[model samples]
Target: MVTSVAPRVESLSSSGIQSIPKEYVRTQEELTSITNIFEEEKKAEGPQVPTIDLKDIDSEDKLVREKSREELKEAAVEWGVMHLVNHGIDDDLLERVKKAGEAFFNLPLEEKEKYANDQESGKIAGYGSKLANNASGQLEWEDYFFHLIFPEDKRDMSIWPKSPSDYIKATSEYAKLLRGLATKILSILSLGLGLDEGRLEKEVGGMEELLLQMKINYYPKCPQPELALGVEAHTDVSALTFILHNMVPGLQLFYQGKWVTAKCVPNSIIMHVGDTIEILSNGKYKSILHRGLVNKEKVRISWAVFCEPPKEKIILKPLPEVVSEAEPAIFPPRTFAQHIQHKLFRKTQDALVSK
Candidate 1:
């Protein structure tokens, strides 16, 4: 995708999307001095979320669908993340989605406030700076698009901006496409786990009330990026996650007692197995924790689509077909939302992010 305003660091390294520095989070201690000053200015100023206005965003690539089922399964089991080459989303849709975000975020605070996420609606909307509080309870480095993705009820077309009508369509289309890809992955996982081909689809249908969500994160140009963060170290609340990232070096994954770069590939989607999935599998599958690091050099854009359970559904044990009585439940039965809120306020990386 061609853009006049993407980060400048895209050319800094050989890896287009796969080159975030390792241990990027822990390296910032002293530089944060300026942040305290900036924080004061932030307190005195009126709310002004940063945004880059664009007429549209577009790209032409199909590279996430070519993975073999075996490879998909292994990615879920081992890394808890993968690079998807083709799963059927167009460049224009992706660009427009990003453009819509740029425009929506650029809208006046009053305009952005009109459709704020209604607790009753279950659609977490509007804008939030530092939305995800980390284990330390400090504000997250970047803001995000936290809203419902499914359950026909949450699709309030009226609340979203129709003037940017094409934006809504693009997001809806993106959601559906991600759902299909998630289903495909789930199916492969079932087979990988030695279950009958249709086992998960049939039994897991109980989770239809579960809806997905999207985190459209745009990290603004930071003067002290290392001192700040785009996101914190936390596992997802859903069963699965598919992340599409452009060239930005902010994404990090927790692995083998250390943080590792996510090796983001252009036109590839990174798959993250979530806490619920790990629980359902009796800890067989992994749910890796990850953090996003903003840069002093440039702004970053990341699109993460979470594949979740139905709202009322409890993401507990997978199924009797997938496991035995000896295995037991990986997690205590609870609603996915409950699990997320419990983790949000809780401290410590190990506390809220596991089975």
Candidate 2:
């Protein structure tokens, strides 16, 4: 759907342009509303996004494990996002993932473009900057590398990066670990929702049919950071998203009427509830709106893996366990492919988003 062939944001930022092109400049009204809300909440000792320790989530002690699940449920219902610590992912492996991405982005422009994504042809895998598909035709100040990592056999290696000798190796290992972690979290959430531990997973398509896709976002330093957004505000379409970043904070969430900046916790992954989960929970849980902000002095990079159901097979809606005569299902059933189509072509407003 992206038709623009504009230069990559990384190239534009490095070119030392005195001001961003008009297309990238957001309207003054838009900037003021976002800027003013963030400033108003800046001085308050606002609530921080909940940080959950996963070390005891599976403890042999029954009481301890129950407490951990309760904490996880509370965070999910209240914030729709949380910081995960002691999540069993190796520190060294996390560093390797980060280095792999940095190496690829550091490649020569001509070399990097070799794997450019052909969005024009309906292919989303590979590297490229998605330009101006919005009403204003404004470009986001970010470039990204996206590819499928799970359903391992479905991986199209041709579009994957080959220059970073260990890119595939590191990312593959990371994806494997994240799959297990996400499954564990989903089980806990299901139990908290009063359903069988495996109910949610089954509804989303069991491991054999689950889909995991990774997007490595690169936000370059902008000369006029306030005039442009690193990424627009939108909720993910998947069930869950696990994010790893390089210790630079730029992620923001719309919470309790204010934009809250998520502070990064070293070695901790940020987890987000996506639209599928909200619909499946029948409004018991939420998928919040989030956006990224650009920095004037530093580049910010993040790796986000979206865990979802097989695109066409799973019909997402409220699970029978969550919906009762007293609590009706607010969302209608729809396959993931249909959901994506509506969002992509602007067929209609997505029902999954409450606002």
Best by lDDT: 2
* Residue 163 lDDT, candidate 2, scale 0-100: 72
Looking at model 1, residue 130 earns an lDDT score of 40
- Residue range 257-305, candidate 2, lDDT tens digits: 8778887788999999999999999978779899888877678999999
Error of 2 at 222 (Å): 0.4
- Model 2, residue 271: distance off in Å is 0.4
lDDT of 2: 0.85
The TM-score values for the models, in the order shown, are 0.72, 0.93
